[model samples]
Target: AAMDIRTLTDDLSVTGQITQDQLAQIAAQGFRAIICNRPDGEEPGQPSFAQIEEAARAAGIAARYLPVTGADLTDDKAAAFAGLLNTLPGPVLAYCRSGMRSATLSSLAQANQDHPAA
Candidate 1:
């Protein structure tokens, strides 16, 4: 299936689950990094993080697996996601099962960036 990507910012985007075959297309779109926000085995036939990471490498895109569930979207995880955005090459594509979790995490991270703890 084609990627249903939604832009969150110039440097970041969120998408639904991607297949290994989609890596090259993602790369061709000039995305320099990928963040997998979906946990492995969330559903039957979903690709594993290891598999996605390997394919991402082959596509010349850096990949990080930062799996997050609804309950796991804590301040710490948002901080981690913010850290990845600070360090990873862009534009970065983050994905979850339906992209909502990834979008939420990105929003949290961006909010933290805008207003850091004093």
Candidate 2:
């Protein structure tokens, strides 16, 4: 499936399936990084991890895949996502099936970053 980049916040963009060509286009459009929120092997027809990573590398954009399941939104995941957000240059694009998990993870990461004591 083709990806649709939606701005969730100032620094975050979430999307559904992002193809290698789409990643390249996004890089051309000045996106700095990408995060994959869907778990590897979750769906049969999804793009492989290596394909996305190779595309990001070719496009000179940073990429990270932190697979998340529906019931696996742990604090560790949120913290890890926050860490990635902090490290990415800017305008990070996160993706998953239907983009729901991606958006949820990004939002939770931002919330966690905002509330240090939480």
Q: Give a tens-digit lDDT track for model 1, residues 12-71.
A: 999999999999999999999999999999999999999999999999999999999899
| Cα shift from native, residue 35, model 2 (Å) | 0.6
- The number of the candidate with the highest TM-score is 1
Point out the worst 10-residue segment of candidate 2 by lDDT: 109-118
> Top lDDT: which candidate number?
1
Tell me how candidate 2 scores on lDDT: 0.84
lDDT of each: 0.94, 0.84
The clash number for model 1 is 0
Which ten-residue region of model 1 has the weakest summed lDDT? 105-114
Q: Write the residue-wise lDDT of candidate 2 on 1-114 in tens digits.
A: 455779988788888888778877889877899999887777787788789999899999999989898899877898899889889888888888778888888778777777
Per-residue lDDT of 27 in model 2: 91
What local lDDT does model 1 show for residue 7? 93
On the 0 to 100 scale, the lDDT of residue 117 in model 2 is 61
